[model samples]
Target: MGKIIISENVTLDGVVEDPTGDEGSVSWFTRIGDADRAAWAEVEHEEAVGAAALLMGRRTHAYFLHRGWASRTDEWADRLRALPKYVVSSSAVADAGWGEATVLAGDVVKEVAKLKEEVTGEIVVYGSGKLVPALLEHDLADELRLMIYPFVVGTGARLFPETSAVKPARLIGARPVGTALALLTYELVHP
Candidate 1:
């Protein structure tokens, strides 16, 4: 019932690995000021309010959700903590710590399809690189939202991978997030 929404921050080259140079992507993301962070926080709040559930890969669960959102006291953090989460993982994690979560350690793609049949509203997937490939390949993801940054990372992991099947996306909306970010919403035009 719920649509799987793939949302991420990407450079012009579609690199979503790590915007901050400490990890391996671009370095400009670190230079943004309070206004930029505030703008991004607003977007997070809006998305959290609209999202019905959280779906992500293991790395996203460990690095982003656990290390990031779980420690916050904000409304968006509250929403994320309260929402039901489905993590696509190869190994079972008994303590994901982020209340109401399930690890789909077996056949992630198939399990996610089943999850889609069970839930309603928007199931947003954050930075889940490994799981995203399967979702895109299987045509399970319904919507794709890219928070396109100002620059490009010439050599890094890209958002769009090599695929034999054509994945068409029709641009539904585009808006600026402060001076540094451009939010682009696209509906996955599947055949």
Candidate 2:
């Protein structure tokens, strides 16, 4: 069965809203060098290549599709573009401009469960802030692989919601990708 893996770049304070600093997002990652960037890219490539498919929230899907990856000629970019992308949204997607991307076949939870039954690899989730909450709510997420930068954002949408319910997760592994980046892996546990 496929494992639902949530992969994201977050701040030390758990903010996943915007890491690219498009709207003054606080992140020390802007100081990363070529070596560190390349190291991170290699990790991303491995994960992307291993996944059976990608699940993205509508907003993330729209933003990314608008960016247009088809013009990129790099091997890693090619691999990323070729992977089947399932956008999770209630409304119909007008068009998935990104290569090989489509609106999920059915309801998010049901379709995700169906995907797990049909595939034996990982079902990777990327940049889906809104979808992550649903995954947690429906007990669908299996693993979390967050690349946390060594900085704090005072405000923004956090990966985890601020509700009273306490979700339990265990640290599975940690990899330091650069001078300040921590690739933290966690497994969600039901109690």
Candidate 3:
């Protein structure tokens, strides 16, 4: 069975929203130096290469599509372009411009449970802020890989919101990737 991994770029305060500052919100993504960004990128690339598939919410998918990730020829973009993608959205995707994607619009828990059984390796979730809490609540997420930036965005969408149920996890790995980033890996401990 595939492990559903929540891979998120987070601030020290646990905010997951507007990491790139594209939304005109507080962002720590661009504050890091070039070397730090490069290191972070390397870690992300490695994760992308190792993942079996990419999973995202509708808005996250749209965000990437809007950024034109589909047309980029870089290695990272190539990896993303070739990976199998799944989108969880109630509405029909007008265009999966990134590539072919399986849309799960039914019961979130049931659809994800079915997906977990169908694949092997890691099904990595990125920037699915709205979908993550549900995944955690349903115990659908098997692991969490957080790329933590040094600073904090005082108020924003968080990977784990205050309203979410407490989900226990044991840290499996923690390492400083560069001057300003830390890579923390944890495995969900189901009761």
Q: In order, what lDDT does every prediction score?
A: 0.84, 0.80, 0.88
Residue pairs with backbone atoms closer than 3 Å in model 2 (clashes): none
Per-candidate TM equals 0.93, 0.88, 0.95
lDDT of 2 by residue, 1-191 (tens): 88999999888888888677666766555667777788888889889888888888888877776666655677777877778778887776645445756677577789877877876888899888878887887778899999987777688888888544677899999989966678999998966
**Ranking of all predicted structures according to lDDT, beginning with the best and ending with the worst:** 3, 1, 2
List candidate 2 stretches off by more than 4 Å: 23-29, 94-97
Best candidate per lDDT, number?
3
Candidates in descending TM-score order: 3, 1, 2
Give candidate 1's TM-score. Answer: 0.93
Off by over 4 Å in 1: 94-96
Model 3 vs. true fold: TM = 0.95
Alpha carbon lDDT at 43, candidate 2: 87
lDDT of predicted model 2: 0.80
Candidate 3, superposed: residue stretches over 4 Å from native: 94-97, 163-165
Scored against the true structure, residue 96 in model 3 reaches a CA lDDT of 46
Q: Candidates 2 and 3: which is better by lDDT?
A: 3
Could you give candidate 3's per-residue lDDT for residues 1-191 as a string of tens digits?
A: 99999999998889999887899898678899999989988998899899999888999998988888878788998898888888999987645457788899998899999999998999999999888988898889999999988886798877886644578999999999988789999999887
